[model samples]
Target chain A: MRCIIRLTLLEMLKKKILYLTLALTAIFLIFYGIAMNYGYDSLRDAEPLMRIAVSGQFLSMGIYALGFIVSFLSIFASVGSISSEIEQGNYDAILSKPISRYEVVVGRYIGILLVLIPYATFFYLSIIGLNLYFGDGVVANIVTVNILKSLSVLYLLPTLLTSVGLLLSTYLSTMGAGVTLVILYFCGMVGGILEQIGHFITGEAKVVLTSIGITTSLVIPSDIVYRKASSILYTTSSGMNFSADNMLGASIQPSGLMLFYIGFYIIIMVVLSIRKFQIRDL
Target chain B: MMLETYNLTKQFNGKGGFKDVSLSVREGEVFSFLGKNGAGKSTFIRTLLGILYPTSGMGLMLGKPIGDVETRKKIGYLPELFQYHTWLTGYELLYNHGLLYKMKKNEIKARIDEVLKIVGLEGHEHKKIKQYSKGMKQRIGLGSAILSDPLLLFLDEPTSALDPLGRKQVRDIIFKLKNEGKTIFLNTHLLSEVELVSDRVAILDKGEMKKIGTMKELLHSPLMLSVGNCSEKIINELKKIDPLLERVGNDIKMSVERDNDLPKIADSVVKNDGLLYMMKRKENVLEELFINTVGEEDVR
Candidate 1:
């Protein structure tokens, strides 16, 4: 298993896509920093500004950007993990060794996650740096929580994508899996929006629609987790100052329950992937 | 049996797996699996390697049940269409597989060099597989298969894409491995290659094991005799002596029930025929056996 993981990591590191992703994320961060610096210079008022508010907003934006980046990168990285091997007949060569099929799936997931870590860390740190630069050190208190939120998005979102990617790789051809996962990511984002709209309508139909949206989000939780992480970063920086009367509501605060849901969602997806892989012909 | 299958059956999308096929390979012997394209050669190999699950029935490898991971450690496999991660050079690929087999780093290095030399790929170790020719890739594939010094090796068309010399090189390596007391389960359509290297061969057609035995066992036991340029009158006269005598293109083809009857048929053919161009017992010898067992349409 260790050997498998090592081989997988080495193979993934050599992929041109991984370096391209890292370069893109770094470029985004540099531009983001320049934009934030300009925005801070424009706002001259400096009377004990809510550092938490500024930091939270910055971190939220970072989470949102990183979330999408990670999701897209993971989809492209993982779409071919299994399917290409099968198509090119290398799956037989790999599986013919003394390795289990489950190890192959899990090892690939871990390898992909390892490749994504540097980009996630770069984005997370850039958000922290941006907060310190713009908020004039007021963002220091909740750096831990902000980092935690970024880490959660980094860790959990990819886990979710990995599972979905594995499941898709099992059933779809490489290109088909890539396109389907991208579509599913968008659908997940739309589902999150519909849930918010359902809250506004306030009826039995609204309740049903919200329930459906929640269930659909649970099925592919990339968007939901991103939103949750964004909310956490936002509230943490703002010190939870906003009243409950806001249009989005204090109910939008990141819930521990959602984190648990994402955890369980990943477990179930991985289980389904394993089961599907076990029965499917290679 | 070092390896055995009990009525192993597999169906893909409701079609194309062999049914009720039973065969075995004994230890330290070369067993050839003969089949044309889509004759389930790869399907059977994958099942044995545990890459594909058997839809029905069972197989045992190295005296244990097939698909057992522990059992697989003792086995080496060379897939038909070998494709390694293109990023890896030949040496890296071999070293990686050696590591998987738990060889020490230095030992892996040594073995990589050794196997590369044995496969006639000595100086090409640093070259990436993407840059390799098909025949070079095949040598690397064979190199990996033998890297672990496994007790059993499963080679699927080990020389299918090779030049004549390359094919001979592969065949020599196979014979050498067999001489080293390793069990080789080969899947190939090259009858002459199989004849030269295999101690036994099995013919599979439409997912069934139509025949299985040593070349001599198959040939002599089936009691086939091919005679050329024999007249129809002599052929009929031979048929009168032995009911199995039949005309095969102005030649007499007969199935002898016993070995002792071969001489009698030959004597009868010569005595009655105007002349005998050639007369020899055809014991389903590799090519004839393959064509006979797999059928003419399937052989091509």
Candidate 2:
């Protein structure tokens, strides 16, 4: 199993996609820092309350982009983890060893997370650092506890995405897995936006939109993760609870029960991936 | 027995995989599976190796039921059309494989040197697989399969990517491994290679086992003779020796069960005053057996 984990890490590190992702990440951080600086300078003369709110908005946008990039990277990195190896006949030699199929699935999941988690952590911290450093006096006084809690929640983004991506890889071709996971991610993103919009309106449509959001979260709790992370960061850091008017923040704080469910969701995905790959004929 | 299967079956949606394959490979024997493309040759190997679960029936490898993780430690496989990890140097691939086989770190290091030497890729081990040619990639794959010095090795078309020299090298390696008491299960459509190394052979066609026997039992050199006489007496004399002798044009082809039958045949034809143009045993006995067993149709 450790061999499998090592192999998976070696594969991920050697792939060109990792270098490209790092290069793009460096550039994204630079641009985000510059954007925050310009926005803070432009809003300097504005009312204090307004300046803080807008600064929070800038922070929310940066976090949103961070989550987006991390989630996609996790998906791209993992969707082909098993399926491509199977297709290319690479698994034949590895699996024929004394290792169990579950080890391959779990090892790869952990391996990908090993790289992605650190990457997501660095990327998450870089965004927060840029927002705090460039926002001057406008950024909120984010305590260490809030930062740690938000980082933990942010870590779930890749863990959850990697789980789902691996599950798909076990049962589908690489392209098929990639396409399905990407579409499901879009579904989660759209569902979150719809639920946010639902909070602002009143009628039968509002209930329908909220129900759709709840259902998509059940399918993939990706959107809920981001929302929960932001809810923790903003509500704790600025004593400003999420409202529908904050376009970039969570419209409604997800319940504590949802976090437990996401944990269960990731476990179930990992378990199912192992089961499917075990019975499968390679 | 190193490997045995009883009524084993694996099919895709109830078709296209070998069925009811019951065979046992003894220790220190080279058993070759002869089949055309899509003949379920690779499928059988995969099933026995536990890469694919059997739809029905059972198998034992190294005395454990198939799919047994512990049992796999003693087994090795080189899959047909295998695409190895091309990003790693050949040395790394073998080291990783040895680790998967649960070898100690020092054990792996020592085995890599021996494996590289056997596969004839000694100095090339430091180069990434992607930099190697197809034949070199195959050699590296063979190196990894034998890295653990497994008790049983399954090589599917092990020489498919090799040139004549490389193929000869593979054959030499197989011979060397066999000399050390390792059982080998080879899958190939190359009849000549099978004839050279196999103790026994099984022919599979369209997911069905058509014929199986010791190489000597399945193959027979039939004698062919060109007789210039058109007399019934000459035909009758030859018929006395081989009752089922076949006449094609002015030639008589008869299966020879023993080499001593050749002189008897010539004497019979000469005594009858038949002008004998030629008398020679036909070559490529395995090829003839294969064509006769599987028929003359192309593999789909």
lDDT of each: 0.77, 0.89
What candidate 2 gets wrong by more than 4 Å, as runs, is A237-244, B222-281, B298-300
* Model 1: pairs clashing at backbone N, Cα or C within 3 Å: A52-A237, A53-A237, B219-B283
In candidate 2, what are the lDDT values of residues A1-282, reduced to their tens digit? Answer: 898889888887776667778899999888888888899988888998888778878888888999999999899988998999998888788888999889999899998998898898898899888877887677767767878898998888999999999999999999999999999999999998888889889999999999999999999999999999988877645576633255457969899999999999999999999999988888
Backbone atom clashes (below 3 Å) for every candidate: 3, 0
Q: How close is candidate 2 to the true structure, as a TM-score?
A: 0.90
B1-300, model 2: which lDDT tens digit per residue? 898899999999988899999999999999999988889999999888888889999999888999899888888889887677889999999999999999999999999998888899989989988999999989988988898889999999999999999999999999999999999999999998998899999999888888988987987778889998847888888788889989987988987788877788788888988888998878788988898888877642
> RMSD in angstroms, all models?
5.2, 3.7
Q: Residue B157 of model 1: what lDDT? A: 89
Q: After superposition, how far is residue B26 of candidate 2 from its true place, in Å?
A: 0.7
> Residue B141: error of model 2 in Å?
1.1
TM-score of each: 0.84, 0.90
Q: List the pairs of residues colliding in candidate 2.
A: none
In angstroms, what RMSD does candidate 1 have relative to the true structure? 5.2
